[model samples]
Target: MDPGLLYDLSMNDYLNFLCVSGYNQTLLKAFSGAHYRCPDIINIMDFNYPTMTIPKLYGSVSLTRRVKNVGSPGTYRASLRVSAGLSISVKPNVLKFDKIGEEKSYKLTVEVTSPGDDEAFGGITWSDGKHYVRSPIVVGGVRGVFHVLDKTQFIDLGKLHQQLNLEVRRKRRSKALSQIAFVGVLCQGGTVDCMK
Candidate 1:
């Protein structure tokens, strides 16, 4: 089976394939348990990538804000917070709308301290003490620390089967041997290799 299929296959599909391929019930159960133990792959779906385009590190972008209120005037403050490996500065962080239909523009500058495959995500929040609004700030061309694993490696059934079998055998042997070795001794009563 193609390695790509491992990533694309749902849990049910994977289990069904295993069953159809003549894998015993015990092996199927073991595979299911191992699959559940593996950490979930992080993907772009895990984070909010706003549609708005942000500049690369050490670059600047202009953002416009317009306030329209037919009833009363309010003061709003703007602030920015970025993820690690990035810094942000907003030239006029605070905005005051003295009247209705007031609009303003600010220059936002970003600096990247570390270059790597990690995503930089943050938000620009505007608040008037009574109400608040936020816009997503995203820095592209970078990946986050938690990222999708390489599906190619994940889909290798032969390697996966070998690992599962080894683990199952180790577990089965350890339980029976521990009782016969020593009650409370290091190396699990010599069942485990402590010197090597």
Candidate 2:
């Protein structure tokens, strides 16, 4: 190798290394909590079931490094550690129903827990009429029916089948009942389910 060219190459490598590891290298750091929204919860109910929305937040830290003579300059990166303070939590993960039915308007309550305060409001109503599982429902005057599907789950496949069964009977009054599998209510939880 040529002496002059080798000296120049070594000098370049040394300068590059010094530039990256020097105490004067600039670094910027920031810690932030990114805004996050809660997931939506919807379920079928013989009557409307009281529901709640829980909000969440994701916290992260960002860092940037600056180098004077690097080929591609410096870079920036951000990360979040999984910890109690890093994530926001909601109270009462499941909302309780005070009074819910398709017959009458029901109220839903929401409780928030995190860095902020808790709030409670009344008069939140849900209607099965608005969302029909099948067929376009006519607006106004036609009262919607609230059929109980499950006493524990409030909404279940068996209950939906029952509602459809009733609709079929209403449509075909004189027709013989179809060969539908009958589903009986199970005594698994009963009142003990509410203690959870």
Best by TM-score: 1
Instruction: Report the C-alpha displacement of residue 185, candidate 1, in angstroms.
Output: 63
TM-score of 1: 0.41
Model 1 C-alpha lDDT per residue in residues 68-126, reported as the tens digit of each score? 43324676687777787766677687767676545555555555566554567877766
Task: Tell me the tens digit of each residue's lDDT in model 2 across 1-196.
Answer: 2111000122323333333443122321111122222222212111111222222211211111111211212221112122222232222222222222112121222212222222212222111222211111111111112233344454455566687788888788544554353323333443335323
Each model's TM-score?
Answer: 0.41, 0.15
Each candidate: what lDDT? 0.50, 0.26
Root-mean-square deviation per candidate? 20.1, 27.4
The candidate 2 region of ten consecutive residues with least summed lDDT is: 132-141
**CA shift of 143, model 1, Å:** 10
